[model samples]
Target: MNTKWWKEAVVYEIYPISFKDSNGDGIGDLRGIISKLDYLQNLGVDVIWMCPIYQSPGQDNGYDISDHYGIKPQFGTMHDFDELLKEAHARGLKIMMDLVLNHTSDQHPWFIESKSSKSSPKRDYYIWRDSKKGLSPNNWESYFGGSVWEPDEKTGQSYLHLYSKYQPDLNWQNEEMIHELYKMIRWWLKKGVDGFRFDAIAHIVKAKGLPDADNPKHLPVVQAYQFFSNLEHVHTLLRKLNEEVLMECDIMTVGETSGLGPEQALEYVGDERHELNMVFQFEHMTLDSPSTGTSRWESRSWTLLELKKIMSRWQTTLHNKGWNANYLGNHDQPRQVSRFGNDTEYRVESAKMLATFFLTLEGTPYIYQGEEIGMTNASFQQIGDYRDIETLNFFELAKTKQMPEDKTMAAIHAKSRDNARTPMQWDASEHAGFSDAEPWIKVNDNYKDINVEAAIQDPDSIYHYYRKLLALRKQHKVIVYGEYKLMLPLDPDLYVYTRTLAEECLLVILNFSHDTIEFEWPDQLAYEARELLIGNYEEVPEERKEGMLLRPYEARVYMF
Candidate 1:
C-alpha cells in the first residue's frame, strides 16, 4: 500500500483554554499557543489538532459555536489565530481546527431567528416540533440529562438538543443550512487550514420522517440518540461533503463518531469513498461504561483481554480498508498515566510502555499536551474546585439523588472532566509555572517531579523516550507502513506484536504486568536478536539462551 503523508504523521492535540495564558488573564489563548509552538516542534509532532476556538456561550465549552467565521474574543481575534497558523506552518507543522457543526449555541443568529415564529424560514433550520399529548414531541434524552426537547416559551413548541439545552441540534435535512455550512468550511479552507477535527460528525442525520425511536428500556426522554446515530442517509450526506469540500482541498479530515462499529467505520473512510480521511471510533474509549448510563469509577476494573480485544478488532478491521486516529488520552479524557497505569509507583516505565503500545500500532498517533512528561490527573478535593459544566451537572445529580457526600466526592475525584482541564505544568514553581496569575484550574500536586523542566533536562526521562519513539516512526518505513501481527497472543502479562514491510521486520514486546516474566520465543523468532532499537528498561541481554526475559512493565523493540 502506498503511504499518504497523514498515514505516518504524529498529531498533538491542544486544549487552548488550558495550554498557556500569555497575558496573565488566567485563561489560555491563541497567543499562548503561539508561544508554545517551539515546544511542540521540539517534541517532534508533525501536526497540531486544536480544540474549538469559535465564538460560543461556552455551555459545552467551545463546542457550542455561535459563529463559524470569527474567533471567540476570549481566545483572541481572527488576526491572532491567523498569526498562530502562519507560525505553525513556518515551523513545518500542519494545523487542524475543531469543526463543531453537529450543534450551535442557542444564542446563534439562526437559532434566535428560528425560535421567533412558525412561519419564519429559519424555523426549519433547527428541529422544532409541536407538543403531542400535552408533552414533549418525542421521547428523547439529552446527553447531559433530562428531556432532549426543551419547550420554547415564545413559540409554545419544543426544540431538540442531544446535549445541553443551550446547544440545539441542527437540521441537516435543511438544504439551505447545509449550503451555509459548506460555505463556512470553504472560507476556513481559503484561510489555509490543513484540515478539520470534525466534532460529533456521525449525529448529523436524524431518523427520516422524524419517527420515534423503538427503545424498550431507558427513560422516555433517553431515546433521542437512537433516533439519529448512524442513520441510513448519513453516509450519503458525508460523501457529498467529502466530494464538494474535503477531497478537493487535499486535507486530512477526522470524524468524532460514536456508536459506530469497525465495519461501518471502514465504510466512512474506505479508499473508494469520499467521506473522511479517518474516523475516531469510541469502541475502545467506551469499554468502561455502558451505552445507557455512566459507570461508577470505583466499580470499574479493566482487564487486559478487554483492552486487547477492543484495539485488536479495530486495528485488524481498518488495516486494509481505511485509517485510524490512535489515541489513549485527549482533552476530554483523564491523563493516561493516571487512568491506565499506576501513576503512584511506575509512572515513567508504564508511560513508556503505553507510548510503545500506541505508536507502534498501524495508525496516526495523537499526543495530548503534557503527555510526554507523564502528567497524572489533577486531584480536586472539593466539588467547588471543578469548572467543567458536565462535572458540575453530574455532581448536582448525585446530590439530588441523595447519594453519600463522600462517595460522590470520590466518584468526582476519579471521573471528573476537570482532571484533564487543569493548566499545563511547565515547572515546579507556583501554579506550576503555567502563568504569573492564578491558573484557571489547580495544577497536579506532584508537579515538583513530573513538570516539563525536570523531564526535559534528564536524558532518561519519559520526554526523551517519546522523542526516540517518534524519531523511529519518522525515519523507519517498516515502523510507519508495515503490516501489524500480534505475538504471544494469549499471555496475560505480555503484549507483543511485529511490524513487517518488504525486507524489514521489527518486533515490539511489552510486559504489562507488575512482576517480571520470561518468554521463550518460538522457532521462527528464536535466532539471536541483533538490533535492540528501543527498550523501556536497561539494555537488552547479550544471550538469547532462554529466549528473552523482561522486568515488570518493561517494553522492548528489536530488529534482526
Candidate 2:
C-alpha cells in the first residue's frame, strides 16, 4: 500500500449551518467551528472537511456560489476565517473547504454578465442555447426537480442548470472561465488551505449538443445522470486542474462523483489519472433508494446482501487502483443511525457496530458531525419545519399530484435532507444547547437523551467508542493500509471482515440484527483470539462447537 498522509488520516465532515451557533443568531459560523476545535482535536480526527462557507444567496444551502473569493457574511468575515485556519493548523488539524466549481448562483457576477445579453463577452461562460420548438432547449430535468433549462428572457435564450434554476452550470469548454477558476484555486492554496472537496464534479461536463435522455419518463436522478455525469471530458478538465493547480501543493482533493461504477470511478481517482485523491461515491448510500426510474423519496426495503455487494466491489476495485472515502451519512443524506440501524431500540450499540464496520475497513473513514454521539433523524412533524430546498420542492410537487399528505410526510421523514441537517445537540438544555435562540432548523426531538454532554459523561457512549476505535486505527497501520476480504457474504444477520497486512491482521465481526444469532466461524478464519482490541460489550463471549452467540448490535475487533 502507498504511504500517503491523506490515506492515513481520518476525516470529519462538518455541515457548518447546523454545527454550532456562536453568537446565538441561530446560525453556525466560522467562530462556532473555531470554538469546537479542541473538542474535535480531542476526538482524534485529523482533517475537518467543512461544507461551503463561500458567499452565496443562501439557495440550496450554500451550494450556490455567488462569490468564489468571498466568505458568506452569515458564516463570518475573512478575518474570522483566517483566525479559524490559523487555530485549526495550530491544533494539528487540516481544513478542507467545499469547492462548488461545477456551477455558480445566478446572482454571481459571471452569471449575471452572462445573462445580460447574447452579445455580452461573458455570454459563453455559461451553457446557453436558443429555444427548441419554443420550449426548453433540451428535455432534461433539474436534480432538485423541475426543468434543467431555465429560460433567460433577456437574451431570448435558455441556460442550463443541473441543480436549482438559480444556479447555472459553468461552461468548462470556455478557456477563459477555466483560467479564472484555476487562478481562484491557486489563490486559496496560497492562503494556506489544506484541501478541497469538489462538489458535483462529475456534472461539470455535459454531453455535446445538449442531448436528451433516452427515457424522459425516468426520474431526473437516473435519466439526467446518464446524459450529464462522469463524462470523458471531465477527466480532461481534472487533469488540467491537477497539473495547473493541485500538483503545486501537497493537499487532499476529493470529488463528489455520482453515477460511477468502479470502472468509471478509476478514471477520476486512479493514481496515474492525476484527477483526485479519492471520491465520494453514491452506490452504497442508495441501497434503500428504489430503482433508477423511481424517486429516492419513494423508498423500499434494502438487504445486507445488496450493501455488501456494493461495498465489497468498491473495496476490492479501488484497493490498488485508486483510493476510497468511506461514509454512510453526510449533509445530503438521512442520519446513518436511523437509516441503517435500529434507532428505536439499539441506537448506541448499532451506531458503534457501524463505526467499527467502516473504520476498520481498508479505506479512510469519514465521520459526519453529530454521528459520534449517535444522533438520529430529525423527524419533524410539519412541512413548514423543513429547511432543505430539495425536500420542499418534492413536497410541493407531491401536493399538486394529489399524493396523500401523510404519504408525503412519511417520505420526508424517511428521506428528507433536513433529517440530517438538524442543529447539533451540544447539551440537554434548550435548543439542544446549539443556540440561545431558535435554530434555523428544528433540533431532533431525542436530543435530550442523546446530547453530547450526556454522552461524554457516559464512558460507554458512542462518542467514546469512536475515540477508542480511532485510537486503535491510528496505532495499527493494517486498518488503513491492509488488504480487505469480506467473510460470510451471505449472512443476513452478521457482517464479518478481516483487514490484513503482512504480519498483522485484525478481524472485525458485527451483528447487524436485533436478535441473538450464532455465527459459525469459517475454517480459514478460525483462530483463538489473542487480544480483544475493542468491543461494544464488556467481554468477548465464548464460542461453542457451532460458533459464538452474537448479541444484538454487538461489535468486536480482535487480533490474533
Candidate 3:
C-alpha cells in the first residue's frame, strides 16, 4: 500500500456556512474557521476539508458558483482565506477546497453570454439545444425534480441543468472552457492551497445522444443518475484533469462519484490510473432509503447482514487496487448516529461503535462537523424550518403527488437534507453558542446537551473517544496499511473485523444492537489479546475466553 501524507490522514469536513459565526452574522466565515483551528488541531485530524467558499448566488448554498477566483462576501474576503491557509499549514493541517466543476451559477459570466443569443461567441460554453417537438430536448430530469432542460427565452433554446435551474451544466466538450478551468486550478495551487474535493464529478460526462433514463417514470429524478453518471468519457476527462493541473502539484484529490459499484470505482481510483486518490460512493448511504421511485423521504428498516455485505465488499475489493474514503454522513446526508445508530438509548455507545468500525477500516476516515460530539438530526416541526433547496423542492414534489400534508411533512422530517445543514452547536448558550444574532437556519434543539463545550469537559465524552481514535491511526501504521477481513460476516447484529499487517493483528468487535450479545472467540488464531487499545465501556473484561458477553453498543479494539 502507498504511504502518502493523505493516505495516513484523518479528514474533518466543515460546512463553512454553519460551522461558526465569528462576526455574529449568522453565517460561518473563513474567520470563524480560523478561530477554531486550535480545537481541530487538538482533535488530531490531519486534513480539514472546507466546503465551497467561493463567490455564489446562494441559490443552492455555495454550490452555485458565480466566480471561482473570488471569495464570497458572506464567507469573508480573499485576505481572510489567505490567512486561513497560512494558519492551518502552521498548525500541521492541510486544507482541501470543494471544487464545483460540473455546473456554474446561471448568473456566471459565461452562462450569461451563452444565453444572450445563439450567435454569441460563448454559446458553446454551456450545453444548449433547441426545443424538440415543443418539449425538452430529451426526457432527462433534474436531480432536484422536473425536467433537466430550462427554456432560454432570448435564444429560443433550452439549457441543460441536471440540478437546480440556477446551476447550469457546463460543457466539458468545449476545449476553451477546460483550458480556463485548469488555469483557475493552477492559480489556487500557486496560492498554496493543498487540494480539492471535486463535486458531482460522476455527472460531468453525459451518455452519448443525451439518452433518456430507463423507466424514468418509475424512479425519482435523483435516482435517474443512470442517465448522466459513470458514462464512457468520464475516465478520459479525469485523466486529462490529472495531467493538466493535478500532476503539477503534490496534493490530494477525492471525487464525489455516484452510481458507481466496487468494480467501476477501482477504474477511477486505481493507484496507477492517474485519476483521483479516492471517490465517495452512495450505495451505503441509500441502504435504508426505500426502493420507491418517487419518494426518498420514507425510510425502510435495513438488516445488519445487508450493511455488512455492502461494507465488506468495498473493503475487500479495494484492498489492493485503490483507497477508500470511509464516511457515514456529510453535508448532503442526515446525521450518522441518528440514521444508523440508536441516537436515543445508546447514542454514545453506538456512535463509538460506528467510529471503531470505520476508523479502523483500511481507509482514510472523514469526520463531519459535530459528529465527534454525537450531533443528531434536526427535529424540525414545520417545513418552513428547512433552508436546503433540495428539501424544499422535494416537499413541493410530494404535494404535487397528492400526498397528505402530514405524511409529506413526516417524510421531510425524516430525510430532509436540512437535517445536516443546521448550525453547529459550540456551547450551551443561545443558538447553541453558534451566534448571538439569529442564525440563518435553526439550530438543533439538543445542542444544549450535545455541545462541544460539554463534550470537551467530560473525559468519557464522544469527543474524547474520537480524539483517541484519531491518535491511534497516527500512532499505528497497521490501521492505515493493514489488510482487512470480515469476521462473523453473517451475524445479524454483531459486526466483527480484523486488520493484519505482517505479524501484528488487531480485532475490532462492535455490537450494534440495543441488547447484550455473546461473542464466541475464533479458534483459527487462538492467541491472547496484548492490549485493549480502546473501548466505550467503563470496564472491558480483560479475560480472553470463549463466548465473551458484549454489552449493548459495545465497541472494542483489541491488539494481539
| Clashing residue pairs, backbone N/CA/C < 3 A, model 1 | 140-221, 141-221
Identify the runs in model 1 with alpha carbons over 4 angstroms from their true place.
Answer: 214-218, 290-299, 539-543
Better of 2 and 3 by lDDT: 2
RMSD of each: 1.7, 1.5, 1.5
Model 2 local distance difference test score: 0.89
lDDT by residue (1-560, candidate 3, tens digit) is 56788889999999999999999889988999999999999999989999899999999999999999999999999999999999999999999999999999998999988888898888999999888779778777787878898998877899999999999999989999989899999999999989899999998887667865676345433345776888879999999999988999999999999867888999899988999999997889888887664556668889889889988888999988999999999999989999889899899999988888889998889999989999999969988888889888888877788989888877777788888889999999999988889999999999889999999999999999999999998888889989999999889989998899988888889998999888888776565645778998878654546657899999988787
Tell me the spans in candidate 3 whose CA falls farther than 4 Å from its real position.
215-223, 542-544
Winner of 1 and 2 under TM-score: 2
Candidate 2 residue spans exceeding 4 A from truth? 216-222, 544-546
Query: What C-alpha lDDT do the candidate models reach, one value each?
Result: 0.84, 0.89, 0.89
TM-score of each: 0.96, 0.98, 0.98
lDDT of 2 by residue, 1-560 (tens): 67899999999999998999999899999999999999999999999999999999988989999999999998999999999999999999999999998899999999889898888899999999988788677778788888888887677899989999988999999999999999999999999999999999999999888877776445433346777888889899999899989999999999999878887889988889999999998988778887753577988888888888899899899898899889989999999999999898899889999999889877778999999999998888999999899999999999899999999999999999988899999999999998899998888889899998998899989999999999998999988998889998999988888888998878888898899988776676555654679999866688664578889999888786
**1-560: candidate 1 lDDT, tens digit per residue:** 85799888899999998888888878889999999899889999999999999999888779999988879987899999999999999999999999988889999999999998998889999999888988888776666777788998988899988889999999998999999999999999999999999998889888876666666665565445667787778889999898787777878889988888788898888878778888887776666554445443433666677777778778788887888789988887778877777687788999999998899888899999888999888868878888888788878887798989888887777677778788888888888888889777777788888888999899999999999999999988888778888776677888888888887888888887888789776556646754778988766654466576688788888785
Superposition TM-score, candidate 3 onto the true structure: 0.98
